[model samples]
Target chain A: MSDYSSEDSETEFVLYRNNPEWKDVTPVKQDDGEEPVVAIDYTEAFWQYRREILKGLNKDLNIELDFIHKVILRQSKNYQVWHHRRVLVEWLKDPSKEKYLTELVLAKDAKNYHAWQHRQWVIKTFNLFEGELEYIDSLLLDDVRNNSAWNQRYFVINNTTGFTEEVLNREIDYTLFNTKDVTENESAWNYLRGLLLHDKGGLSKNKKVTEFCENLYKSGNHSPFLLAVLVDMCCEQINEGGGDSVYNLDRARTLCNELITKYDTIRAKYWQYMLDGIEKRPKRARVKRLLRAQIKHMDS
Target chain B: MFTSETMPSLKFVPELHKKYLLFILNGKLPNLESMETNRTVLMYFALAGLDILDEIENIPPERKESIIKWIYSLQVVNEEENISGFLGSTNLITKENRGKNSPYKWAHIANTYSCLLSLLILGDDLSRVNRKAIITSLKTLQLPIGSFKGAKEGVEDDMRFVFCAACICYILDDWSGMDVELMVQFIMKCISYDGGVGQGPELESHSGSTFCAMASLALSDNLHRLTKAQFTGLRRWLLCRFDAGFSGRPNKPIDTCYSFWTGGALKILNAYQFIEDPNNDQFVLMTQDKYGGFSKWVNTVPDPMHTYFGLAGLSLMNISGLNKMFCELNTTRRVHDCLKKIQEKWK
Candidate 1:
């Protein structure tokens, strides 16, 4: 029997330095004294030898997982550590505990990209899509601005039920309700736009969504995201070339003007670019025309 | 001590920033242990940061030669495993197992990209690079899904590696290393509903991944693969990211690095001119450390990565006293031109 102790818990974990089996191994310290810029101490051989020893001893999978968990606690963003964890989970063939591990890491740092990626992989590979929506909802409830949660919600919906007509309606309603609470919440607005994209006729075809935006606009909500979506719907309407093409074009132009002059002034140049495109004028001509109009308006 | 009121001035301070990079290049800071795995990337940032500051000549020629040699020593050309690229550090290869075929010693795509650019920045000719071996090995890293793994043993394959692969092939003046059509398809699939690209399919649309995808497409001459609507959508998505500096995702805090990632993507899309430059410049400058370098956010300790990208973000705005950067390759114009000449010779 290898000297590896199976009784070790997470807190009482033994490192290579304390382990009697690894005492003979002369661990290479990083040559930071010589090379200041690129002194990487651990080599592939070091890790390979450790893995070989673990495999040779027929060590419990929990020990390896605990060791990785300890390392991840310190270096949550390390790609290699997360990759090793994934490999071990696959070997263990039970992903039941993986989500909990990722959750613990994420609870510490919500935007830790590696943790999120690993969670997504475990959830997808093991078909553990159940309750993922509730998990996402809890994350968003904690912080509605967590874009990662919003993205995971999209991922779960797409992979499981998909964006069926019924699913789309439900998502639209959910996203609309959230948008009403925080009209400036870009994530919720982006989510709504994502749902509308799944519709056959694009943003303009979603009468329900258009009505939502119109109601919000009429109610004195001038959030840049809200106006941006309305402008997109109007442009779609103009492109589809129905009886309301003229009205839609006029509304789109007015919204673009408002976006530039009043709301969304930070992105004024983009709004101007949109206006130029709507008028189908050359860029230089559009710029010159805008300059002339601004001068005329200022003089008047 | 470095509040806005006490901020020195709204100046680029190339000298102070260059001093910080030199400290990174010549001096050993104890805090760099966390960056041991990414030593090559750290070196690239220092060297490239100096080049951007127009102070590459500060490094004596002998030191430059030694650095060049060090970079070349990390190259692995194993024909059996079809692995040809640069490792991040020599710590992975001990004397006993040196030159042996081990999965752990596989060359990494990101390391290779950084090493190649570092070589050109140091004025090394392309004679030492094993073009054939590297390109041959690069072909094996591509997956059927058109994305690329970082190495032969790498489990994580994403847009970052795809970008690195594109940079490697483009720098070597070869396209046989990857399947451009499939790669383009993969990038297209990564376009999230928000119109920004992500690390992979169904992932969150992030500024860094969007930059990687768009820059890869541009480098591979596959920009035309995007439909007109997709192009417009991408432009809108990029333009919408600007709030003070920029954010990787919606509702995220404005970070200094996104100034380059999102700004670099906009530069490629011809939409960078639309950004409110003064606000971005002020935001980046506010994050400048009083000692030297820029941090990810104001009041944070500055690191080499954020410092290099802060300079890069300014370089995109054509900041005074800074060298013009070729945003696609993330190197200076002079080095890019040198690379172009090397490619011309290859043809």
Candidate 2:
């Protein structure tokens, strides 16, 4: 049992009694003579009372959940209302309706943070990851760049226990297939990396992975997200020192320089910072000096 | 329907804006009726607006005392709960329950931060601040994972409250309340793969949380903890936020708020020079209404949040006639100057 009455000590103030939005409804007299009855709509007053109760953190369980549902319907973005709902769901031990509640809330605003957070809680508490991939797929079909949906997809895959090599490979293929036509979609690109990171074959050693990236690069799609990923892969390879020589670092630097000077002007300073980090690595010190001389000659 | 020559030229209305803020502070705003719990935050906006206009001296003497007293009334001085931070508003506190025994009273980290800042801005000596109790209360709100919930009974832990807790500690000149290493670890985990920080691990990266995390790091003096590669990634992600104005995330529409969120983050990272000043200024200017405030975008209603951020964005760009902002703290130079004096007194 929780202490609910003590929290409700702030209920001395009146609410919705003087709100101008609502008026006392008058009932029309029946044709046959009878006493005139008053018609009252208590929606605003009821909501006002519920809001005050929720604000005080009163735990009435079922009533609190109903209040939260109504509050969310009107203002889906209110964090406090959703937080109260989360507390209620945890206490009630029945999160079965949470999935549907989240779906309803998110139907109003797909990117509602509280709704997404609630859905994540539901998925974890109920192990509802089996059908999540398809749900994410439908959301992505509606808009490929829905990062919230992409984040959910990532959450489901990474947090759930069923992520096998087969699942990861299929996820990679899904990203590639969905992103084939878009010039630059950072969500799909990040998803590709997320999936690849989980693959046991590793990012650079995977034949399909390398081929997929090389083909995208060769197609003149110099997207910043794509270039950034490719450059990272090359740096990882050079750091491994698998007989590519220090020239591999030089090529990677060139790619980053191109990213700085040409394609991604927005992130030029970031590329420069990355380039400086590359030159300062202890392993690359010898080759970095030589590259500096080469750059000086080119500048001259 | 009108010709180009007949269109009214838009301009910032400083005096009318001051009056608008004062009107909101008078507690009679019908438009703000729903925000009863967040009246102190609204007070911050009004006070910050006046501070920006260099008109803080215009507050009448009695009004200043009442405002200070009102802020103190929202504080929870109870010893049993060990929660002695400021509540968001006194609307929840009634005449019948005005003592230390009121069970309805609660303190929020955000309200504490705002209360402290408002006091500092109003030139109060902060003698009334319960430094030890507030610090202890802050520690109780911290999770073992280094994040902070807003209050004891509030929602999940995230970067927003972490920033608020950091600000509270910074204002009190105390770092003992928080576990610095754990907080740093939490912040690092919040850094998304794309380099922009999220509210928490696995959440979508957002500009607001990125600002909060960066500000927290800056306040804690732990920004150097980020590796060279990590710093570059963060700088890259933040710079890429610019698309005419800025968006909180990768695919969202440009909003006026991210101008401050992303811009403040970039400034803290020391990469603000890359911001396209002219385009950003134009975008922010587009959100200005003839009525003396800035909205989230053109053709929308203006609110205190957007207005404050819009002014802050311009100030970041070295716009004339606006107060210079302390990027990490998100306060004006005047307020920071007052805080510096308070620090000197403490020393």
Candidate 3:
């Protein structure tokens, strides 16, 4: 791993710099000398050799930036090339091109994992968070089911500023608006939970969130994600001494039945598990409520 | 996505696939001309695919011996560099430059893993594997954070190589190659709040990486380190991966590979019982090609990697006519039994 201490350091460096030069490649005559080689451009060989060159880099060394960029343009999925590019960019102290390069690569393949990971690195290294939300919006508009875009949105919102109530509420609204028509999008659902969990109090205690969920439920809308969230809120309420059986536990149980029977059959077992938890919650809640009444009576 | 009450009549062409593996072994694979770097992994897929079909006995003894010889020829024999593991193929090595003095003396952990498994599947005695030197090479590849690179050649240190290193260590019946605490720390950092593990810290939870993490933890015997809530959350995340077939992550389309990648993770976590659904079986069957092998999606081209893993998923679900697989080692039960005998000899 320590390349500097090795005896073959010079040869290894030469291997790292041994990328094929396209200008040196030319058509060659056939063995009979009758006609020029039809497809003797050696383009495929050049690219394969270029990949070997990139793969030869050691952690302690560097490579030419132009070679790294060309290799990345040819093979965007080759994360080793991307790592080399990142190392060169940081070594040169010029990270200005990373964002543009990542964008260009993503334009070709939107869900390229290496491109996404590089984008996050570039954003953090250069503090290039401006207009990130708009970028995420564009990605989401193209495909609302893109979890990478949602994860990036979560990163940008949380890292760019403090998670105050105003920011949290705005994020909730943003996610809610996107999920209003499509409740099956796990990206937006996860985003909503991620944002709400950062708040001081949970989602059940928030009036706007509770009303929003109640309105969605009462309007005869049947999104399994929405029902699941509503059930969670109901369970939380029931566990918090909100002992209104009609509104909290009973509604949650009915929704659990709906989830198990009609919606989300893929995860019916999980819903059953949730229902079992709901059943167990009452006994614990009863014990807590009795203890609270006894303490109040003693105080009186 | 089929909504019919009856399951599809899936065909499993064991004979055609066996012939295909033989062709691949004989170097008749024009489509894989440029995949020389991944030759060892491809070989593993082919051999293991046949093993899962219980067709290893169909190969002639001489052919199996030659395959084992080819795999051994790729092992790096450097003592000074201490990187004594198997290279991917002989493409990087020439006859003129084939010793400790050779400049191309390097080994990739992933390739080493494939070579070792293929040898075990071929019933090769563990006499030739330089366990001490391979452990030393593994130590050099491990980062301070416990992640490992595939090779010493500046490759990305991610969960993939970490899993490979863990498997190599497990195969050798040795834990001296890595720092268990640091490895556990790295894996812990990879576990997202959503319960799924990622490739590294702060990355999105992915099913493949989650499997690698789980398998690494299982191999290291440190799965009990997870808190109860974390364990439950992981189970929930894995169980929720099903929506007909398993997807790698939330909102992703179901693919056949995740049937094993995610399914294998669930099996390793001892939570396979919770993943109850007839739809998973139907969806996996839907990806089977009419000729042979399985593809990532229905109606797509079939490949070796997906074919092996698809059979592996069926084996995990106890589908009839398929041999059970050892999920942690990614081998058929027969190969795993051979490995246990080898371990007994070592003891």
Q: Which candidate leads the pack in TM-score?
A: 1
Off by over 4 Å in 1: A1-23, A26-53, A242-247, A281-300, B1-9, B95-103
lDDT of 3 by residue, A216-245 (tens): 888887788788778877776777775454
Cα error, candidate 3, residue B138 (Å): 1.0
Report how large a share of the reference interface contacts model 1 reproduces: 0.40
Candidate 1, residues B124-239, lDDT tens digits: the string is 98788999999999999999999999887735799999999999988998899989999999999999988899898988889999999999999998888889889988998888
Minimum summed lDDT over a 10-residue window in model 2 chain B is located at B1-10
| Model 3: colliding residue pairs | none
lDDT of 1 by residue, A18-85 (tens): 77998999976432223344443332323335655777998887779987777777778777778878
**Separate DockQ for every predicted complex:** 0.30, 0.15, 0.18
Where model 3 places Cα greater than 4 Å from the true spot, the runs are A1-71, A234-252, A281-300, B5-8, B99-101
lDDT of 2 by residue, A1-300 (tens): 001222234655333345444347443221211211111111112223444576588656786676567667766776766776776777788887788888887777778877888788778877877787787888899889888898888788777654587887777778888877874887788777767767775556667777777788888878888788777776666656521542266767888999888987656766777677666663575577689999999999
2 or 3, greater by lDDT: 3
Model 3 chain B: lowest-lDDT 10 consecutive positions: B95-104
Best by DockQ: 1
Rank by DockQ, highest first.
1, 3, 2
Docking class of 1: acceptable
After aligning candidate 2 to the native by TM-score, how far in Å is the CA of B344 from where it should be? 2.9
- Compose the digit string of candidate 2's lDDT tens values, residues B8-100: 544555666666666656635554545556667878887887787777787887778778877776778766787788976654455456645
Clashes of 3: 0
Alpha-carbon deviation at A45 in model 3, angstroms: 7.6
